[model samples]
Target chain A: MTFTTFMQHLVNSISLGSLYALIAVGYTMVYGILRLINFAHGEVFMFGSYMAFFAMTTFGMPWYIAFIIAIILTCIFGMLIEKAAYKPLRDAPRISIMISAIAASFLISNLGIVFFGGIPVTFPRPDIFDIRIVIGGVSIISVSLFIPVITAVALVILLYIVNHTKTGTAMRAVSKDYEAARLMGIDVNRIITFTFAIGSSLAAVGGIMWALRFPALIPFMGIMPGLKCFIAAVIGGIGNIKGAVLGGLILGFGEIMIVAFLPELSGYRDAFAFIFLIVILLFKPAGLLGKNIAEKV
Target chain B: MKRNNKLNIIAILAFIATLFILNVTLDPYRLRIFNLAGIYVILGLGLNLVNGFTGLFSLGHAGFMAIGAYTGALLTMSPETKEMTFFLEPITPILANIQLPFPIALVAAGLVAGAIGFLIGAPVLRLKDDYLAIATLGFSEIIRIVLTNMQTITNGALGLKGIPGNANIWWIWGVSLAVVVFMVLLIKSSYGKVFKAIREDEIAAEAMGVNIFKHKMMSFVIGCALAGVGGALLGSLIGAINPLLFRFLFTFNVLLIVVLGGMGSITGTVLSAVVVTVMIEYLRVLDIEMNLGFIRIPGVPGLRMVVFSLILLIVILFYQRGIMGSNEITWEKLFDFKNRIAKKITRRKSS
Candidate 1:
């Protein structure tokens, strides 16, 4: 590939990876705390994008204001989903919770179709994001630059919250041992709720960034990305936060680079993430960054 | 036990009689729905083997079904239809002229799916819980993507049309009954106990001398084979085969039936299969304009799915055991009902 083309692909991978990283954080955090795969997390991301769309169109808010409001709304919706679908079934069998999560995902997407209609909507692009930068004959959109910067900032903030704050300590304690954390005067449920809120807010940011990049909004758009992000989380050692970002970048580059080199297999682009996931799962169930936990017989 | 045997024979006869009567009386549309429900029963039973009986959370049912559907369709399709459908890219020469009878093709499809399932399960069954679920799900997606990319073989996304419709209600229900009987007998055997033991606690089962890998592979393969049979019948019923037909939503529906029917209960799976299939059809009205007494409400295209999903969510949250709660319909229960009927008749005569 030419230098300019290589540069363009690199830029594209970075932007895509940022989105995956943002979504994967939500998946990893929830899995870390609850030992539950929150299948509805992607729907939370989809809700965020749609919220941004509605805030701009229906409420006539400016883009920046709408973005902030959308993230906040998405956080509330995420928590609401947990409370309604997951909270009651906390003590039940794991299968029930998983089924509930799948059902919630279906419900949210179908409801989105019922409310948003099945047709794809054009995402509103503000003038501020319309700017494009050209470096060494490789043109890059301003949003592409903003995505990675925003993701880096979010990752730093997330690290600070998880490592430094009191709630972060509580979260770590809960994830390590739920009953033990409770015995130590930690409000386990409260920490979980906080985790969901933060995770979902990150999903909103990712969703908004994703929509800004793609410029289209559909009810079921989250499924593929959601699955891909989950794969990314698994690849990065499912419960590790920084591993999620690393895995996202690897997935992003793998997808872009595979298609870039082999145009004949471009149709199989979506399958790459899944195939990678299976291989990683089979050969290394603990993941690249995950520590192996022995299965008790 | 002798009296129960007599009652069981009579019940079987009655059921067959009812099925024959319904087959003759129902219109083509309703017959199609009935056949689809029978197919679903086969699929649900097959899935229940792995998910409900063996306790392995596999989400690759769609992939297996796709393999079966494509295999059955390709084998049964005439050269003319194959030629017509492969206008985008010519089909492979070896597959072009081969045509098998529907039943043989369906069996072959099942065998192929079973073999593939064995291969996939050999490596994947080692993973536990959610990891297995995700890996299986990934395999299914890979199958879909491969199908979409391999235009010469699968006709790409354009899909194959004009396959013979050999899936009548009799054939569908006949296969469903055979599957049910096989499952019932299998569950009654020692192997079934082993499966249940694994489901209850795999490590303990392993400690108890059960070969977890072999038994899990058996469940996965058998389940996949039945899914394949269902898919073959479905292809024949629809008279078309496509990658889109075996999308994750199809697996989702089957999963819903298996869960709602009470996971290891054969009777529950069969009953819920019929109910869920019919309900899905019944809810079609929600997607269309329904003109009530006065106001004609505009139809919402995706509202039925919304309602169905909500129901599934509520059912999982509040009624996790579902309608059957792992209970089977036994001979004793049937005999008790018969005895009650006899008592009512005797009391009427006395009165």
Candidate 2:
């Protein structure tokens, strides 16, 4: 509990928090527009990490190139998910769409099991990533500092696109009222695809960072984090991007701090977010930043 | 009332027959799996009440079950074994002293589980659909993580072992059958209609004076309680229980059962429970080595799980409506559908 140790843990928690925030933004954006949970986002993140792994190991590409390739493919893949699983069910009940998303997620994970095998594999840490930087008498892992920076840049980029762009306006319009947006000559389909692509790309970056930090990959890895990120989205107010980031940091840091400070109850750390989610759902059903989404009775 | 009367009699007769036949001609292992299936059937049906009938997406059934399993495990175990196996000091000494009979333990498990479900449902049931799903999933994980880490009570990761293995085929089947009967009766009542209306349109249901929160909690608790009974049966059948056994995979398996059986369909759930259990067990045969003359190959490990996952994927992709969709087995639909099929066959034969 000294200053140095506390600072070290803070850096660790922040890095972890940033990655969660990155993945969570994707969830919030998609949910904002489509009102679907995008259950496959976790798999998309997994896809990103695996793609990076292949780029670095099989192709022998440089670290940055590997990351770029992974992000590009995941973005395209996310859009495809919308095109394939969702478009057909556009007119169906939202439940069916959610179910379809779950199916797609299961498909991807099982496919991963087939291709990548069931065991956890180590992520390749580049030489630069292995180096730790000392600041203010605390040694921080290079990856630890790198994560928050990546998250901030991604958040800024997303904010700019959503606030200052035509596509963003269209997405907002569609989210508010699909029929109304359609009537206004908004390319509803294109906006959705773009939403999926952007969300997926961000998830890819999160996934990449997650791998570098946790340093392991497995088929079921997404199950816990995916659920937690969804919680982050909910806690921040579903469909609000900034809310999602805030929620993610709160959850990620909350989880790590619980485990770190309450060492005796470290095993219960994972449950902490879930307990918070339940409490939040009970108290502030709309979440921290979520407005009332008046349901049509 | 008419359908209820008819189904009640048929269910009772079937139960008697199953009890008679099971007693007359089945080994413990076969009976065990059948008992497991019955428990799962109950779990699926309970989940169907909330997720299927009420249109609430909840994924915390396992958490409810852990509560029930621990309750039942504590009740059934003797004081000495409880002392020797778990923590140095018994957390619930009353639990250690609770050498309740097997049937009592199972019932207690359901009740205790239902109570926890009530507590959890009060808070999380407000979240409808996907948010509710995440929240509930978190609840389940929290329950598990807490249960795992609470070495003072659940013995942590080492798991609670050597609980009384007294729950035979009859107990599981008896309890499951009772739950199904109870739920079916509930579903046919006026209260059930309100639940369905809420599912169809929550806003409209609320406007129409259906207390949405109450109905959702009712279903959620009942489902969770049944899942608890399932977990208790699982504990009894194995004679020991570990946190690892009830992983997210088990949740997915039960979910597949519900979806495959047809989300809101009781008959579909019963049928699919049989199908999935049999299918999985059949896949277990894949673990055996095979010889094809030219090249002999040993069975790959975890092949059954892979195959099961593949089947689940296929089901989700192509047969998402499952066997029955949201339809139930009412007498009119059954008789009318049967007659229509008969007439079609006769007409074809005549042609």
Q: Which candidate has the highest lDDT of all?
A: 1
Best by TM-score: 1
lDDT of 2 by residue, B135-194 (tens): 777778878877887776788787888977776767767777777778778988998898
Clashing pairs in 1: none
Shift of residue A143 alpha carbon in model 1, Å = 0.5
True contacts kept of 1: 0.89
Q: Write out the backbone clash pairs for model 2.
A: A297-B203, A297-B204
lDDT digits (tens) for residues B36-92 of candidate 1: 899999999999989998888888999999988889999999999899989988999
lDDT of each: 0.92, 0.82
Residue A172 local lDDT, model 2: 82
Residue B318 displacement (Å), model 1? 0.8
Question: For each candidate, C-alpha RMSD in Å?
Answer: 1.8, 2.7
Candidate 2 CAPRI grade: acceptable
Compared with the true structure, the alpha-carbon lDDT of candidate 2 equals 0.82
